[model samples]
Target: MIGNMEIFLIILAALILFGPDRLPKIARELGRAIREFRNSLEEDLAG
Candidate 1:
């Protein structure tokens, strides 16, 4: 399991890599992709 410090460091790395402007857009896209993937998985299980 990841701890708080690890998560902080990952966020810091992301900030440094992507800069401030594009991070939120990238994060939102990632979230949507994850949600879609999870929904597909549930559909497959139900069917």
Candidate 2:
């Protein structure tokens, strides 16, 4: 719960800093990066 609150705060800060126009593009790129990182980590663990 506390961690979620912190994440929410950070997201709010990012939105303020980046503005509405850039935030969606930033989020999409961030999501893709996270997905790629998780996939690579899983592959490493399997190997």
Candidate 3:
């Protein structure tokens, strides 16, 4: 399980690597992709 310190370090690394301004947009797109992927998997399983 990831602890608070690990989460903070990951966020800090992302901020440094991607720049703070682009992080939110990146996160949003990542979330949408994950959601769509999960939905497709669920549909496949259901069918």
Candidate 4:
């Protein structure tokens, strides 16, 4: 499990890099992109 300090650092870095307004949207898009990539890999493996 990730420690609280590590999580806090990650959040801080994200805030610094993305700012408050864009962070949530970027996170959501990144999550979606990762999910889609995983799904595509699974489909390829299945076929």
Candidate 5:
């Protein structure tokens, strides 16, 4: 299980790697990928 410190470290690392300029774009793409994955799972379950 990850704690708050772990989450913070991950975010810090991401900031260092991607920088502030591209973080929002990366986050938006990640969110869309997750949303699409969930939608596909729901469709599979319902069908």
Candidate 6:
């Protein structure tokens, strides 16, 4: 499992790489992708 410091470093790297303006947009897309992936997994398990 990742520690808080590790997570913070990852976020810091992402901010530097993607910049502040695009980070939120990227996060939103990532969230949507995760949600869709979870939904598909649930449907598959239910079916």
In order, the Cα lDDT scores of the candidates are: 0.97, 0.95, 0.99, 0.98, 0.98, 0.99
Model 2, 1-47: lDDT tens digits are 57988999998999899998999999999999999999999999999
- Ranking of all predicted structures according to lDDT, beginning with the best and ending with the worst: 6, 3, 4, 5, 1, 2
Model 4 per-residue lDDT at 16: 100
What TM-scores do the predictions have?
0.91, 0.78, 0.88, 0.80, 0.89, 0.93
Instruction: Residues 1-47, candidate 1: write the lDDT tens digits.
Output: 99999999998999999998999999999999999999999999999
- Top-TM-score candidate index: 6
Off by over 4 Å in 3: none
Once model 2 is optimally superposed onto the true structure by TM-score, how far is the C-alpha of residue 42 displaced, in angstroms? Answer: 0.6
Please identify model 2 stretches exceeding 4 Å from their true place.
1-4
The 10-residue segment with the lowest total lDDT in model 2: 1-10
**Candidate 5 or 6, higher TM-score?**
6
Q: Count the backbone clashes (under 3 Å) in each candidate.
A: 0, 0, 0, 0, 0, 0
What lDDT, from 0 to 1, does candidate 5 have? 0.98
Task: Flag regions of model 6 displaced more than 4 Å.
Answer: none
Poorly placed runs, candidate 4 (over 4 Å) = 1-3
Query: Once superposed on the true structure, which residue ranges of model 1 sit more than 4 Å away at CA?
Result: none
- Give, for candidate 6, the lowest lDDT window spanning 10 residues: 7-16
Per-residue CA lDDT of model 4 for 1-47, tens digit only, reads 99999999999999999999999999999999999999999999999
Per-residue lDDT for 1-47 in model 6, tens only?
A: 99999999999999999999999999999999999999999999999
Alpha-carbon RMSD, each predicted model:
0.7, 1.8, 0.9, 1.5, 0.9, 0.6
> Model 5, range 1-47, lDDT digits (tens) per residue?
99999999999999999999999999999999999999999999999
